[model samples]
Target chain A: MALTRDGPRSLGEAATGGTLRLAGYLLLGVMLMMFDHRNGWLPRLRGAAAMLVQPAWRLAATPGRLVEDARRQLASAAYLRRENARLRDNLLLANVRIARMQALVRQNRQLKRLLDAVQSLQMQGQLARVMDIDLDPFRRRMVINRGARQGVHVGQPVVDAHGVMGQVTEVLPDTAVVLLVTDPSSALPVVDARSGVRTLAYGAGRGDLLDLPDLPVTADVRVGDELLSSGLGGRFPAGFPVGRITALKPDASGSYLRAVARPLAHLDRSDHVLLLRDLAEPFGPPAPAPAAGPPAALLGPAAAGSAAHPAPALRHGAGA
Target chain B: MMRLDGQRVLFYLSLALAVLLLLLPLPAALRPLRPWWPALVLVYWVLEAPGRVGLATAFLTGLAADLLAGTLLGDQALRLTVVVFLALRFRARLRFFPMTQQALALLLLLANDALLRWLIRVVSGVPLPPPLAWAAPLAGAALWPFVFLLLDALRARLRLREP
Candidate 1:
């Protein structure tokens, strides 16, 4: 640069510096790429980088969010009343179910005590808002508003009102990244609700479908059979609806059946989700809470406050 | 002689706007046609002021883009660096070209950048993207004249200097 300050330098003279710089930059990029691919050597760096860009993302998303908010505010009173009434009915139904569930839990505890079997713990869910959706066509991911600051940890299971949505893969200070169940890289162990046929369901990358590959031809999975998390991996709680088998095809060899199912969760549309925490021992009572008249009492004031904040299009997970 | 004061603010502001456009969500049907905003903005800087915005700026911007877009960490860094390097090498002619010729050159540069990105993705084990993915560079090239005009106007309005 100093040498060229006096006059315009020839292309050859400039190319020397430019080529050296390009090589250095590419070398750095390749090294970072390798480290990122192998064992995630720089999560902290990524987190810091994400933090730096968070403001831009937030700013970019503001117009959309504001429009959504304005639409919500413009909802007519009759519409609001109808939604409220429906919610009340759902809450009433949920309370009745919770009461029955508590009784069954007590009876099950007694039975376990008599049989000398270990106890099972209850799972708690935290509410979080979906901050942004990944626009990269190759990956299905969402950023949630909760993160390490809110006690969210990596590998925690996330769900919406209808069913399992995804798992929290990366947690930063203020947000966590969720790889949706519809992403190609995601897989979960699930079982048929009717016949209890266990199989692995893999995301088909189509936003709404999962593929159950390698099921033997004799596998009893049928269309309309609900697939539930089997608790085999212990990462996700058992019995949550994963998807409903929608189609089945036999492999070319006719030895294995390939099944496709639609995820029960509204993966692309839901704006809020529940993050399950402290799954406790595989078989132990959930953490004790004041069993007030409603199940909402279980979430304590802080949890209830966050959960009931009326976020746009958010639905509380059904009765835990 | 071009004044040199206050240009840094305009330079950074244009880049920020590009980042915003990159993150702005488009409807699903239109997503494939979304222009590569950062590439266009960086191309402008490479042509208009090569000394100030060089390989390092491109690399850092690419890193930020990789983080924002949730892509492999350095994939975009390498792509952007490659384009910026090429642009700088030909900056003399590119800066002097008529609008039509400049847009054509930018189209090739953006195409090279897209191909490099596809190569990196394939090398990194991603399946080949659909043929539709190649449309981004063309879309970006189509928008280049507008982006160039808008940022140029912005620079003039802000009384930004040329290096």
Candidate 2:
């Protein structure tokens, strides 16, 4: 640069320094990419940076929300009445199911006590509104309006009313990023509800399908079978309805079976989600929380706040 | 060494608007057509106010973009640096080209940048982009004329020119 300042120089000569700087920036970019791929290395820094742009995320959601709001207000009275009746009937049906579930839970707890087994789970749910939908088309992810300030943290299980949706992969001051179960890199462990055969459900990458790989060809899974979370992944609570097996196919090697299931969760349109505050299963490493059976009143604020979920602390070690 | 002038304010404001445009939410059907706003703005600056807009400004803008877009850190930084460098290297000829010719050059440049983005996504082991993803460069190119005229109005109003 100093030499070029006094003498006539070719463009290449003048740009040598610039070329070197460009190379340096490119190399740095690759390094950052690698680090980010490795579970978003340096999440704290990313979280802090994410705070500055939280408002932008909010602003982006406003137009869509406004449109929905306007449509809701302009809805016909007959449509509203019909929707209200349908919802009321659905709520009544759900309440009955909940009552039956409570009775069954009591019976199960009594049986566990008689067998000297671990205590039952009691998880709570927090609702958050989705702020952005699939910010990037290539990846299955969405941003939510809840964040660290709302006790929304990484590794929380996010579900909609229908079933499992995804897990929180990142959190900012007022927004969070949830990695959908349909993302190519995501995997969920599920069991055939009838046959009790456990298999891993991997994201099929097109955004709405999950493929069960590595099941032996003779595996008992069949079309129309119900799949439920097996609680083996530590991130998801057990017994949640995952998806239904849609088809079964034999792999190229002919030794194992591959199954595809359409996820039950409304992955494309679910705007309201609940974050389950459940801890890890009992089989996980010993947790910092006290032994089970303590009253909610006796537990500390963090534990008590999350006590509604069966055992959330056990998995914090694994997922966090 | 930017002076506190209307041109300088307009430069930063235009860049901010570009950033907002990039983050603006669009319906799924319209997403593929979202122009690469930052690159278009940078191209305009490098061509019109070469002394003020360069590698450093591009780098910081890229970082903010990466952070906001939730993409890998430095990815946008690297892209901006490359765009600025290419623009600077060819500024002499690009300045004299016809409007249509300039827009075509931007199309090719942005298309290559899109390819770079695909490579980064592949390296990160994410899902491959849909075929419709290629439309971004085309959309960006088509939008160049309007962007050029708009930013030009601001620069010309302030008498912004090459140093």
Candidate 3:
């Protein structure tokens, strides 16, 4: 339809048309905003819209990727050698750590057996590259290259080398949006490493700081204390480093202490992140290791107890 | 009847470039300084070719912007409709003004757009935008003169007849 009549129109007619059009759009905007707020009805539409803009996002990132590739290709041999040496040293150190970890794993298994607890599956993480960063100042989010096709689902925890980055919030067919922990709306359950006191940490909407708004005034939360995921909600796996307490001050009301934390993840610079996924259950301890087998003697007192209580062990192991 | 003109290609190309700029990431410190590129382009067309860029065009552009920036749907739609409406209402005066004066008008238009957007966002449960949301209007207005000249040059170079 023509925005205005074809013939020359009076100023009054033009003004009335403009007012009517503005009212119509404003009404549409309010309706949409209300619908989205009340029902979150636009995500499917948002996903389709994201698909339309996906190519633009990729095209926008190509120049930066090209520059990075060129830089890598043009790196000096000496610099590359130094980098390789550093990586080798890191690997050596990591292997040494793994050696220690093996003993710890053995001890953990023995302890679990003593307690008659079931074995936990090895957690796996998938790698994804950051495709685009959200430009909204109020919301700290980014789009990653993984999505439903890659088995990425909403609420999967994402982490970088340093610590917990955030969780996937929205997934498309080919890409997903991650809500960083620094966004005002993001909250995660964390436990103090020193005291094991669990508290919910929230994003303060400011970079480099997370808010713990519910800490009691008498709580023993000290600055520099490391916080790890407590896994209370089952959304994020337990024991991932989240952040460290950076500041604490009494609330203006004097009933609670307001605290701040510095997340360990490089929220701004990291181009890659890890998406944690739960592994499928393994067979139940090999069916009690075939009771009559010769190896049954190696079952130990704990295993015998577990075998006697096969009902509990099987249930716990299967649930995990 | 309108024929396919070389200037239509130039128009769409510039609009695409503006979209690219809108999507381009900036350093953290400078991110808040990004101008409203799509709005600027929209306002330019609303002024120079009012018949081509109207309320419907502005609405679609705003929707595209919302998806591109990952904001709530129709947030930019509302703001852009207001911008285009105001531009169209005053296109006669705005087109006659010197580029510098037109920039001033653009500053008001963009500031109004940002304020309206911020209001809608907050009302719709988004966290209150930081002070830098206001700073964007200044940036948008500052780029107006350059954008105006560049698009003008493109149009003149294409030698497309104005309606």
TM-score of each: 0.82, 0.82, 0.86
Error of 3 at A208 (Å): 3.6
Candidate with maximal TM-score: 3
lDDT of 1 by residue, B1-163 (tens): 3644456677887777776676676665565567778789998987766656778999988887777777788887888888888988998888889998998998899888778878887777753455666887888888999999987887676553333
Task: Report lDDT per candidate.
Answer: 0.79, 0.79, 0.80
User: lDDT per residue, candidate 3, A58-171, as tens digits?
Assistant: 877777677778989999999999999999999999999999999998998899899997746368999999974444656788888898999999988899988999999888
> Could you tell me the lDDT of residue A69 within candidate 1?
95
| Best first by TM-score, ranked | 3, 1, 2
RMSD, each candidate, Å?
12.3, 8.6, 8.9
- Per-candidate interface C-alpha RMSD? 4.3, 5.8, 4.3
Which 10 consecutive residues of model 1 chain A have the lowest summed lDDT? A308-317
Best candidate (score: DockQ): 1
Off by over 4 Å in 3: A1-13, A119-121, A279-320, B1-3, B160-163
What level of docking quality does candidate 3 show?
acceptable
lDDT of 1 by residue, A65-120 (tens): 88789989999999999999999999999999999999999998999899997636
Model 2 lDDT tens row, A1-320 = 21122224345653777788778777877777677768576355667667567776776667778887998999999999999999999999999999999999999999999999784577899999987533655667888889998999899999998889989998888888898888887898888999999989888876368989899987888899999888874778888898998989999999999999999999878879999986546455666665445444446576655565555444543454
Compose the digit string of candidate 2's lDDT tens values, residues B1-163.
4446667788898888787677666765676667878899988987776766768888888877777776677778888888888987887789899989998999889988989888877776667776788888888889998999988786666664423
Query: Proportion of native contacts in model 3?
Result: 0.45
Q: What DockQ class does candidate 1 belong to?
A: acceptable
Q: List clashing residue pairs in candidate 3.
A: none
Error of 3 at A244 (Å): 1.7
Model 3 has an lDDT value of: 0.80
lDDT of 2: 0.79
